[model samples]
Target: AEAYPKVKRNSKFKVLDAADIDFFRSILSSDELVESRSPEELASFNQDWMKKYRGQSNLVLLPNSTEKVSKIMKYCNDNKLAVVPQGGNTDLVGASVPVFDEIILSLKNMNRIRDFDSVSGTFKCDAGVVMRDAHKFLHDHDHIFPLDLPSRNNCHVGGVVSTNAGGLNLLRYGSLHGNVLGLEVVLPNGEIISSINALRKDNTGYDLKQLFIGAEGTIGIITGVSILAAAKPKALNAIFCGIDNFDTVQDLFVKAKGELSEILSAFEFMDRGSIECTIDYLKGLPFPLENHHNFYVLIETSGSNKRHDDEKLSAFLSSALDAKLLSEGVMAKDKADYDRIWTWRKSVPPACNSYGGMYKYDMSLQLKDLYSVSEAVTKRLNEAGLIGDAPKPIVKSVGYGHVGDGNIHLNIAVREFTKEIENLLEPFVYEYIASKKGSISAEHGVGFHKRGHLHYSRSDIEIRFMKDVKRHYDPNGILNPYKYI
Candidate 1:
């Protein structure tokens, strides 16, 4: 590794004592920081779920408390070291895994539920708090932290807040942006600013706490958060509807949304290829719908009560069925049935990867232009001789996301990972997104993966503003120095 030279006005910060390993060890538990002396020890967090970025910088630092993280940050700040904060490491863009010259700050050790307020409907937990664990915490207290995702068990609250992540329930409950009430942040200078007050309204001054919410920890490390929980719906009804074309699918979606407002928790679509992949991955978990169909939608509704919710859901489905807006429809009768319907939607990513290598792109675009942009991207890639090629990133499978919220997740599969493919696909995808007045990053923030794509989503003025923010908060460029802005 290269030396950590003095770079800025605050360049007198001390470099870490790699020789005095015990100094670092005292900040963590015995099981916290693990280096690879053996293959089995390194296998757990070595390879991230994202297959594209698979390099290793495994000086993994796992601090158990905010104080420990603060101390580590203070040390790193003094040394002008860049720290990559990770939780569960379930990131798709390879942001969780590090490049060659950085140390990993794994938040897996700090997961702990601090408080549960049923009356106010807020849950305070450490950043490493797993979504699934929070769900169970809510169930125990008659509440739930609403940031739902497929990797609920693995992805932690810290990562979710850092990414300002969006998932299936985003259509109804809104993403982390809306539901998060407060946060406890670790600034780049190792100072702890506790915003976990759980107040619904605080119009004292500039809402400065928000800047780090989606900054992806490049500006600072988020130690814990206080989230406003969405009350758990008494009943959940899921339906699988297959459409023949994108136009028809769009029409049906508009109609369904026109009728149902917040009850429409999820409106995810599954391509035939994605459906088949799920069926293959889990033997008994059949696709539950026709594979030949060009597009399939798994619409889910969660209402305040069961019987009343079902009646309203039935009316919506019956009307759609009679209107011929849907080619097929199957309503879930039980929990098992609903899970079966969801398998198709969640399999979209794994399907894109399992079949071959993959390039995953998630964008925030106008709902009307979602499918249209996909078509355009595919056409442009085809013209560039990248779409149908064997070892290039090919737009082979397309799925639906928080269609109700205008966030779509699309994937391209190839036989191998190559710099050439990224070079070609990036400009093509990002430029098209910009053309459509869309953001290159929808839920996922601009980490290393989307650093180059920032200009596409941002204006010249916006880019300069972001640079100013970086300048003010991290003038030394010591906080995750090569990421975001």
Candidate 2:
């Protein structure tokens, strides 16, 4: 494994022993309990999706049911052994991986759709259920999971809820906090707390489920989820617009929301650098435009009335063109075209990292200043003599994101991860976002990556309250120790 900066293991947590392994083996089948002589078997669980953070965990427990999970947690908590609750392992931040020798508690084996009520359009399922599988099941019942992402094929529903992932369809369906009704979680002490309710409205005291929705597994392990699915739209269409300037991009967004109104599902933006990186990474995949523009916007509409949606989108586009808000544009003629257009926008993440490494910052900024951070970082790197072709640690800076929601993904692609480059970015990026009254993290939680930098976005009192909540739930701090509270 690649060497990363070493993080000291908490002295309060106990190191796993043979007795602990024996206990896990007793409750789980051989297949469920993984301990390999070769280190490669546990590599997937030890390293994060970004391959930036690595752990030295030798054991990974895959409980087949919540009961098994409770038993394992109870033992770990009693022994004060640190545990990392992991799902699909698709987290961008370093939250899913162990920081040291902490045991990995994977939920992959517990995947199962428990129940679905067609009349109520609510579904209950294990936390390990893949997002794509949930979407397919919902589609069969003429319903849809409100969240949608490029990693849907592997990302688990519980994982998204844990991170409160706001994906492509967030603009139309809202966040997971609003859509998820209840959850079944395993506390650090192995106590099972089930708030699984199918009711749409509940005036009960203290909606406790919300606490764990975006807690990032520091408080507890989520085993099951109850979410309200959305009704499938009858018609969907997409359009790609090339804008001459960032100001015009903002104008187009305002016009789109006003004209497209309720039918607008997504409004994503990509700057020139983002598009160039995507085009380079996806070799042979042409840009959607005939001529290069300073900025690009992907607008999508979904509604029950196909004719009405199509007319609305067309009128909106015409108005945008008439006002000279966009320089060029293209509308999808069919499903194939729609998918192709979205591919360009979704390809930016991987493309930015295609060179060697990518330093990602997912931030919520004021609409007009969304892309300003990326530009500032690029200028700073250039001034520091870090950015260049090969041999240089830094490559280039790119920005893209859900424009309508003011969430910008600022990515700094580099030839490799180096302390010099990291030092230049940290605190600098956080301070800039704080100055703009923007959040340090928008969707991705403050895992191991942003734990120390929480003050950038939250007040001291807010952080203190968060720490108190952590202590109340997991007094021993064995559940995901060394992570953000």
Candidate with maximal lDDT: 2
Off by over 4 Å in 1: 1-20, 36-46, 381-395
What is the C-alpha local distance difference test score of each model?
0.74, 0.89
TM-score of each: 0.91, 0.98
lDDT minimum window of 10 residues, candidate 2 = 1-10
- What is the per-residue lDDT of model 2 for residues 58-168, given as tens digits with 9 covering 90 to 100? 999999899999999999989999999999998988998998899999999989999999888899999999999999999999999888998898999989999899999
Model 2: residues with Cα > 4 Å off, grouped in runs: 1-6
Judge candidate 1 at residue 341 and give its lDDT: 77
Which tens-of-lDDT digit does each residue in 389-477 have in candidate 1?
45545636455566677777767666666567667676878888988899888886676677656889888899899889988877767
TM for candidate 1 is 0.91
What RMSD does each model have against the real structure? 3.7, 1.2
